[model samples]
Each structure stands twice: as structure tokens, then as C-alpha cells.
Target: MSLDYEEFNALFTQFERTAIHLEMRDSYGTAIELPHMAKWATGEPDDLAWLQDWCDLVREGTQAGKSFRRAHVIGEPLSDYQRWSHSIMQPHIDAGSEVRWVPRRLVSSIAFPGNDFWLFDDRLVVFHNYAGNGQIIDFVTSTEPADLRLCKAAFDAVWPLGIPHEQYKLD
Candidate 1:
């Protein structure tokens, strides 16, 4: 079912005790807080250490069998995407967690077909669509898987086509 903006915000605010899966397109920001942790993910640059800390929390949660997944699509060729995504994801990769990146085409094929994209957690799944006047309509669901596997598949397919971050020397 669909939820209005306020209802969606309330549901997200109350979702601290369960696993969450997120499918994000375009760009946005989210503030996530767990028992002893809190984090912010956006298109902007965040402290690397802070992201590492969250990765650790997620790892601990995983060990105890808590489900958590985040899938992001790179819509721009901006360095910020690479930097932030890599920083937030490096720790998980180091610990052998499955982190995936999907391209726009694949994501569009699987998504609900709109502009603002989707966000899914254990409490609710939000389909955010722009109303053409800076307003948004959120379609929420409580049963979506966050679909990280499909996103991963798409990433695996696209990663090889892009330049490795290490080799990219931006002036």
C-alpha cells in the first residue's frame, strides 16, 4: 500500500529493531540510527571513519543474523559518487560483505518505473516520485527484500565497463 509523507517518515523513524534493505536511485539523504550507532548517507562526502563504524555495526548485526543491505545506482559520473560509495563500502568489502552497484538501465527495469526511486527497510518500502513542484509521493511496502542481489548482478555487469577508481587521476 502507499503511505503519505508524514506516515512514511514516522514508519522510518520507528524502524530500529529490524533488518532493512534499501534500493536508491538518483540522489537523496537518509539518517539511520541503530542502538549504539547512527549514520547519514547522501551524495555528499561524509567522514570515512564514521562510515567505517557503521560498517562494523552492520557486520556485527549480520553475525547475529540480522538482515541489512543497501544498493545504490550511480546516475552521474561525479567523483563524489565514487568517493562516497567506495568509502562507505570499503569496510564491508574488507570484511567480505556483499556490496552491490547497479547501473541505471538495470535498475529502471526492476524498479517501479518513476523518477525519485525507492527506499526499503524492514518497517516500510518507499517509492518516492516527484510531483513536479518539489513535492513527493511515497509508495511504501513492508515486504520488499531491498533486492540487493539483483542490484549486485547489475553492478557486476557494469563495473567492468567503467574505469577503476585507483586509475582515475582527476585534476
Candidate 2:
């Protein structure tokens, strides 16, 4: 089924064991991040206030024995948005989310599902759809056997191939 933004964020607070997110896009058209993105363009250290809620959720979940992992598959010559996202992702990592970077070229052999997804506890899968220009479109959540298998297989194939956040450098 489809989920609105609030419903999407609510999953973080409810998953029983793990939250695995696979991000395939380099940019997100976010109004909430506009000022921060602009500041980043000028080489400023963007404020962390905007991210507090998510970070808190991650921190609390992890502290409660949940594992939160995110793998980002990005292309060469990172876009400005990628750089911004990389910088911002650290806070989530610090809050106990295991984040990794996988350069896209090396993973061509594996089949991708075209959209980004969040797999919760190996059960529910939420696919994130976006416009060509990076605008948020909608999210589809699934618990079908076939979909879970595909998502789990795809994620397992890519997760180990990713470099830890600290070791990955955008170039």
C-alpha cells in the first residue's frame, strides 16, 4: 500500500529488529533542506536541528537493540546533493546507524529494483518513488513473499560490497 510522509517516518519507531535502507538516488528535492543545501554550497557547516528527530529515532532504536543499516549506491563524480547527503549521513551513523557507500559501477551485475527501499526486520518493504527531477512522489509498502525475497537478495548482494562511511570519500 501507499504511505504518506508521516506514515513512512513512523516505521522507524516500530520495527522490531532491523531497518535496512537502500538509497539509489543522488539527490532529493526537499524543501526542508533547501537552506541547508544552499549553505553547504557556500562551504558552511549546516545546522543539525533539521535532522534531530530522525537521529533520535535511530539512536533510540539502536540503543534498544535494533540494528539500523543504510547502503547508498552512487555513481562516479558525485553530485552536489550527494556530497551534502554524505556530510549529513554522519550524524545518523554517529547515532548508531550503520551506513555504507557502494560505488555504482561495481554493482552492474546485480539487478536493481529501480527505486529506493526500506526493509523493516526482513518483513515489510517500503519502496520510495521520486520524480526525474528528484521530487518526492510516493511510497509503496509490501510484505509479499516474492518482493521480500527480491529485496532481501538484492540488499544482501550489495551490503557487503559497500565501504564503511568513514572510509568512503566522494570524488
Candidate 3:
């Protein structure tokens, strides 16, 4: 039904070992990150060299066949950080990996109905309440194909409508 923070962490670590399909969506902010995600994605370090090494390891993991997919639908177009972060995945995309961009409205209409957003990793679903005090208040289901397919369909529909990166500059 639900797991505390330690349990959730262990489960995710296990998921990493098994190489399951991991999918997530989030709004842009510094406070909302899991400590590891924050450190890996946008962390400052005491030593620049160590930070670069960590970044290299992340890049290696990403290249070594991690099926990670994410979508961001901001109120407006992406901010500079969003753009940069999304751009960082270009090499993976070029290598024929599964990364995507879905319009936020379509995602809102489908997966995240009413309030809170959903994170679907194979079957483990985390429903986060955005309207609340910014905590991940619920862990709903695990690896439901029907629900995942529905969300994917919504993403597919919106993805085609997204302007390509080259065209983004023109906008």
C-alpha cells in the first residue's frame, strides 16, 4: 500500500539492479527532489573533480541501457534549466533511446487528473500531491499495464505536437 522513506529507497535501489522501466514527471524546483536525484542532476560539490567524476558515472549508467523516460509540461515553455536538462539527453536520443517530451496540458488531462502528479516506474506508482505541503503523500499501485498504456497514449498524442529542439529556438 505505502512505504516509508527508507522502504521507498530500498525498493528503488532494487529496481535499479533489475533494470526495470522507470518513468517520471516533475515540476521545476530545487526543493522537490529526492536527495540522490538532486545530487545527480543538479548538485554543487566541494570538489569540482569529484563532481565531474560523478557526472561521468551518471552518463555511463544512462548509456549502459537504463530505460529512463521523462516528460515536463510547464505553464509556459521550458525555462533555461529545463531546456538545459532536456538537452542533456540529446546523446541518448541520438543513439535511438526512449526519451520523450509531452505537452503538460495533455499529461495533466490524462495521468495527473485534478491535482497531484503520478510517477510510473514499471508498476510502482508514486502519486504526489502538488497542492499539499509538497510531499509525496501516496504510493498508489505497482506496474499496471493498463494505466501505464493509458498514460503512454496520452504522452504519444501530445508528443507529436511538440516542436523539435531546432524549432524551439525560433519560438
Candidate 4:
């Protein structure tokens, strides 16, 4: 089912054990992110003060014994957005979310879900639908056993292949 923003954000706080995100896109055009990305492109420094909300959520979740992990299946010679994302990742890492990067070529053998997603506790999945221009269209959530299995398996298969954020370098 499709989820509104509030409903989607609620899942982040409500998950009991873990939250796993698998990002397959090399770029995104999130409206809120454009300004930050533009600053990066111009070589301007970012205080990253805007990320406080998410950092706080991750900090609280980890302190509560919940785990958050994200794996990005990215191509070599990263897109501008991904490069900027990597440069500004220290705060999220410091906030307790474990982020990793997987080279796309290494995952050619494993099948992946059609869209990027977050799997909460290996049970619920929130798929992010995007337009061709990388603008988010909507979020779709699923609780079907098949979907759960697919997402869980996909993430598991990708996780071990990822290079930790600190070690990953732009190509």
C-alpha cells in the first residue's frame, strides 16, 4: 500500500529491532536535498546542521538497542549526488547508523527488488518509487511474506560485499 510522509516516517521510529535500507540509485532529486547538494557542487562547506533530525533519530534508536544499517549499491565513478553523499556521511556514521557502499558490478549475480527499500526488522518493506529524473513519486509499503523474504535476502546478500563508509573512496 502507498504511505503518506507521516506514515512512512513513523515506521522509522516504530520498528522494534532493526532498520535496513538498500539504496540502488546513483542519484536522487529530493527537493529538500537539492540545496545542500548544490552547495557541495560549488565546493562550499556545509555545517550539516540540517541533518540533526535524522541524526537524533538514529542516536536515540541505537541507544534504545535498535540497529540501523544501509547499503548503497553504487557504480564506480560515483554520480555527483553520491559523491556529495559520501563526503557528508561522517555525521550519520557518528550518529550510529552503519553505512556501506557496494560496487554495482559485484552484485550482478544476485537478484534485487525493483525499487530502493527499507526493511524493518525483516518484516515490513517500504519501497521508494522514483521518477526518471530521480524525484520521489511515492512510498509503497509491504508486509507480504514473499516481499519480506526477497528484501531480506537481497540486503543480506549485499551487506557482506559492502565497503564501510570510512574506507570507501570515490572513483
Candidate 5:
């Protein structure tokens, strides 16, 4: 079933220990993230008002003994949006979320999911469906053992190979 934002947040926030996200796209064209992204493309710094909610949540989650991790599988010659996204993720990292960059070609042996996902406590999985322009289409959560297995394997196969956000050189 598809979950609205409130329901999704409620479910995710309930994770007892770890929440892991796997992001495979090179660029996300979300409207709210565009302005700052645009400024970043031009080498001009822009204040990000849009990420406040997420920032707050990461902060709170980390404060309460939860581990928040995100792994980005990016190609060589990073996209403009990826560069911008990396710059913005520092605050999330500072808030104790572990953000890592996995160069895409390195994980060819593993079969990856078609969409991005959030895996909570190694049990539940939430897959994110996004339109071509990056508008969210829906979020589907599943606890099926097969899904958990695949997601967990894909994530584990990539996480250690990824460079931590602080060490990833800006392209």
C-alpha cells in the first residue's frame, strides 16, 4: 500500500535503531530543492530553507540513539545536481547521519532495486517511486523476507565501498 507523508514518517520514526537509505539516481529534479541547486551549479552559495524539516528529523533521530545512513551510487563525472546534493548533505552528516558515496560501477555484481529505498532495522523496507522530474509518486513499505533480504544485501555490498561524505571529493 502507498503511504502519505505523515503515515510514512510515523512508520519510519518508529524504527528502534537503524534507518538506511539507498539512492541510485544521479540527479533528482525536485522543485523544492531546485533553487539552491541552481545556485550551487553556478558556484554561488544559497541558503537552504527547504531542507529544514529533514534536518530537524535527522538531528532528533541521531540524538535519540538512532543511526541514519544513506548510500549514494553515483557515476563518474558527477551530475550538476549530484554535486549540489553532496554539498547540502553536510548538515545531515553533521547531524550524525552517515552519508556515503559509492561509485556505481563498483557494485555490478549485486542486483539493485529499480527505485530508491529506506530500510529500517533490517526488517521493513520503504521504496520510493519518483516521476521523471523527481516529484514523488508514492512510497510503498514491505516486510516480506525476500525484499528485506535483497535490500539488505544490496546495501551491505555497497556501504563499505563508499567514501564517507566528508571524504568524497567534489567533482
Candidate 6:
């Protein structure tokens, strides 16, 4: 099923055990992030106040014994968007979710699904479909055993190769 924003938001807290996200894009045009990215491009400072809601959610989840982890399969010489994303990740890290970076070059042999996804408790997969320019097209959810297995295995293959956010530095 295609999920609206509210439904997608609910999945974060709805999952029972783990919420793991796999991000494959080098850039994204999320509306909320454009303004922040622009501010970053001009070298302006942002207090990142807008991220508080997500931070709170992650904090709450972690305290409840749930795990939130994300793996970004990023390209080398990070794009402007990725660089800015990396800079803003500290707050999320502090809030409780663990962020890791995996260089794209290192994962050429692994078979990944066609889109980005969040695998929840190894049961449901929420696929994030984006247009070529990185604008979100829609959010799709799937629970088929094959789909779940692909997502789980893909994430597993990539996770071990990730460099924790603290140790991943831009060149």
C-alpha cells in the first residue's frame, strides 16, 4: 500500500523491535530540507530546531529498548547535500539513532532493491520512491516474505561495512 506522510511517520514508533533505514541516494530534495540546505550552501548557521520532533521520537524509541539504525551508501567526494546531511547527523546520533556511512564503491557486488527503504522489525518494508531529481514520488509499504528477506539481507550485508558516523570523515 502507498502510505501518506502520517502513516509513514507512525511506522517509526509502531515497530516493535528495530527500525533500520537504507539510504542509497547522494542527494534528495525533501521540501523541509531545501531551506536548511540553502542555509548550509551560504555558510549560514542553523540551530536545527526543526529536527526536534524526530530527535524526540528517536530518543523515546531508544529508551524503550528499540533500536534505530541507518546506513547511507554514499558516493565518495560527498555531494553538497550529503555533506550537509553529514553535518546535521550529530543531533540524530545524540538523540539515539545510530548512523553509519557505507561507500558506494564497496557495495557493487551486493544486490539492492530499486529504491530506498526502512525495514521495520524484519517484517515490513517501506520503500521510498524518488524522482530522478531526488524529489519524493511516494512511500510504499510491503510485507511479502521475499520483499522482507531482500531488505533484511541487503541491510545486513551493508551494515557491517559501515563506518560509524563519528569516524566517517569527508575528504
Q: Please give the TM-score that candidate 2 achieves against the real structure.
A: 0.95
Give TM-scores for every candidate, taking all chains together and pairing residue i with residue i: 0.44, 0.95, 0.48, 0.98, 0.92, 0.99
Looking at candidate 1, what is the lDDT of residue 49?
58
lDDT of 4 by residue, 3-107 (tens): 988899999899999999999999999988999999999989889999999999999999999999999999888988899899989999999999999999999
lDDT of candidate 5 over 137-157, digit per residue (tens): 889989999999999999999
Candidate topping TM-score = 6
Ranking by TM-score: 6, 4, 2, 5, 3, 1
| Each prediction's whole-model lDDT (CA) | 0.45, 0.89, 0.44, 0.95, 0.88, 0.96
- In Å, residue 80's CA in model 1 sits off its true spot by 2.8
Compared with the true structure, what per-residue lDDT tens digits does model 1 show for residues 100-166? Answer: 5544554444533233333333233455554443344455443445543343344344444443333
lDDT of candidate 2 over 1-171, digit per residue (tens): 999999999898889999898998878887677789889899888678889988898899989999999999988788888888888887998899999889999799998787899999999999998888788889999999988888888889999999999999866
Q: What is the lDDT of residue 116 in candidate 2?
A: 92
Clashing pairs in model 6, backbone N/Cα/C closer than 3 A: none
Off by over 4 Å in 3: 9-12, 16-60, 77-121, 132-135, 163-171
Better of 1 and 2 by lDDT: 2
Candidate 2 regions with alpha-carbon error over 4 angstroms: none
Instruction: Order the numbered candidates by lDDT, best leading.
Output: 6, 4, 2, 5, 1, 3
Candidate 3 local Cα displacement, residue 146, angstroms: 3.8
Clash count for each candidate, listed in order shown: 0, 0, 2, 0, 0, 0
lDDT of 3 by residue, 98-120 (tens): 44444455445554323322343
User: Could you tell me the TM-score of candidate 5?
Assistant: 0.92
Best prediction by lDDT: 6
